[model samples]
Target chain A: MSQLKRVQQWATFARVWHIYDAAWQNPFQSAELLKKYLMGMHKPIYHPMNDCGDHVIVINTADVALPGDEWKKRVYFHHTGYPGGASWTLAWELHKKNPTMVMKKAVYNSMDRSLQRRYTMERLHLYPDANVPLNLLENVSNQIKQLRPKPKRLDEYKEEEVREFPKLIDLPKSYIVE
Target chain B: MVFTSVVNYVRARGPDEIWRKRRIFKLAAHFIGRRRNCYSIALRNVHRALAYATKGRKLKRADMANLWETRVRAGCEQHNISYETFREGLARTDILLNRKTLADLACWEPYSFKALTDIAKRRALDDGLAGIKADTSIDRIITRGTLHRDK
Candidate 1:
C-alpha cells in the first residue's frame, strides 16, 4: 500500500479509548450504550471477524444507580457445579462485595453469546471511582455522554442560587420545618 | 452432421461429456474428498456453490451499505448529531454525498467529515429539524443557507 493508504488504514482501524462516567447511571442501560463502543459497532469498519473493538474505561461504577428498587429486587445467580452450590446474591449485596461487578456483569450479559465475548470484555476497564491510572486516563480521547442527565442533589446547589429561586407560596414562620 | 439412425444419434452426444464434467469439477476444485474428484458429486456441489455465489453478490452489496451506514452513524454520534438529522441536513444543504463516500470521509478524512457535520448541524438548527436541539457549541458554524436567513 502507498504511504497515505497505509496511514488511512491505521486511522480507520485505530482503537479509540472512550471514558464513561457511570455515576448515577443505570448499569443495564449504560451497558447497552457501552457495548456499542466496546465492540466497535460505532465504527464503519466493524466486522465480527475484525478486531476493531475499542477500549472503554468506565468510572464511578460504585455509584451506578439501579432503576427503582432493582438494588434490592434484582438477584445475580451463580452455580459452583456441585450439590447445594448454587447461590443468589442481591444486586446491592454484589455491588457492596465488588463495586465494579454490577457494571461489569451488565456489559457482559448485554453482549451476544459468542467466543469473542471474553476477549471483548478484556478491553473494558472498570473503576469503582474516578481514580483511573494515569496511563489509561491519558489515552481517553472521547467521553461517552450519559444517557440521562445526572440529577443534582439539593445540597449540590449554591446557597445564593437556592435562596434566589422563585417560590409559588412562601411558608409561614410558624410552620414547622421538616 | 446427420445421424444415419436413431441408435447412432443416441450414441453421439452433442458435446464432449468429459469436458462438460471438467467445467463442474473445475468449480469444485477446492472441495474435499469425492466432491472434488467425482463428476456427479462435483456437479452437485458446483451448482449449489454457484447459487450461493449469486446470492452472496447481492448480500455483499447490502452488507457493505449497512456497514457504511453504521460507520457514518458512528461519526454522526461522535459529533452529537443523529444520523437522520445529519443526512437531512446534508440533503437540505445540497450536499449529495452517498453513504459509502460519507463513511470513507468519516474514517479516512475525519476533518472533512467534521466540517460536513458542522454544515449539517447548522442546517438542521436553522431548519428546526426534529431530534436536533439548538446548542451553543454549533452556533458559530456559518453556512451559506444561514447567511441570508434572519437570525
Candidate 2:
C-alpha cells in the first residue's frame, strides 16, 4: 500500500503554517485568508464538526495597513456590567498599544462564533515583528503568501533611481524635488 | 319590500340535499363518526378540533424549543460545560447564536459545538468585571516564557 493511501485513512488533522513579510498588507484580506485555514474550509475533508484546521503563525503585524480612514473610524466597544462602564477603543489606538492585537482581533472575529472558534484562535500565533522564537518557528511546515502587495518603504528606493523614472508633468521650480 | 310568490321548501334539493351545507359542516367533512354527516355533532367536533389545533400550535412550538434546549444541555454536559454558563457567556459576548443551531452543533457536530463552549468559558472568565463568577473551569495556558530547541 502507498504511504499517501495510508495517511488518507488516518485523517491527519492539522499542519502548522507560517505567514510572514506581510508589511503594509490589508487586514481584511489577511482575515479572509486566516478564516479558510482556521475553519479547515480549504481542506477536501473539512466537516463542520471537525477541528481539522491549520495553525497559522502571523509575524510582522506592526506594519499592517487598513484602507481608507479605518484606523480612526473603526471602533471597538466593550462594556462591563456596572452603570456606565462601557469603553471604546479606536483602531489606531489599539495598534499603538499592542501591534499584534489588530491581526488577532481580525482573525478572531473571522471564525464561527463558537467555543471551537477559541481553539482555532489559539492556533493563530501573532508576532509584531519578524523575530518569532525558534520553537514556534519550527512547527511551521508551510509558508502562505500575503493577501496584498507589501508597500515599498521610502528608504528602499535606490539613490540614483529618481532620475530614471518617468515624469508625468513638469514640476514647478518652487516644488523642490525630495 | 315586495314579497313575490316565493319559492320556499316546495321543491326538493334532489341529489344535493344540502340543508347542512354551510361552511362549518364543510370544515368538518373529513372528521370521523356521526360528526361526518350529523350537523350538530359535526359543528361541535369541528369547533373542538379547531380550538385544540390553535392551542396545540403554540404548545408544539414551545415543546420543540424545550427539546432543543434539552439537547443543548446534554451537549454541554458531554463537553464538560454547564448550559447556563455557555448561554450566559455567549450572550454577554454578543455571539448571538440561537438554541436550535447550538443544539444542532451539540448533537451532530460535537467538535464545532466544543469550540463554542471554549469561547463561552473564556468569556465567563473575562466576565470577571461583570461580577459574574464562572460556573465551569476550562484549561488555559497564559504564557510562553521561553523558547526551546526541538529535537
Whose TM-score is greatest here?
1
lDDT of each: 0.91, 0.74
- Each candidate's TM vs. the true structure? 0.73, 0.50
Put down candidate 2 lDDT per residue, B37-93, tens digits, no spaces: 788888888889999999999998997787677678767665556788889878876
Interface RMSD, model 2, angstroms: 11.2
Clashing residue pairs in all predictions, respectively, total 1, 8
Model 2 off-target regions past 4 Å?
Answer: A1-4, A9-11, A163-178, B1-151
Model 1 TM = 0.73
Pick out the ten consecutive residues of candidate 1 chain A with the lowest summed lDDT.
Answer: A41-50
lDDT of 2 by residue, A1-178 (tens): 7999688556555464755555788877789877776776554344557667787888889989989999999988879979899999999999999999988888787766887888888878888999998988887877777766676676788867866678899879889766
What docking grade applies to model 1?
acceptable
Quote fnat for model 1: 0.67
For candidate 2, what's the RMSD? 21.8
Candidate by candidate, in order, the iRMS in Å equals 1.6, 11.2
- Tell how far residue A107 is off in model 1, in angstroms: 2.2
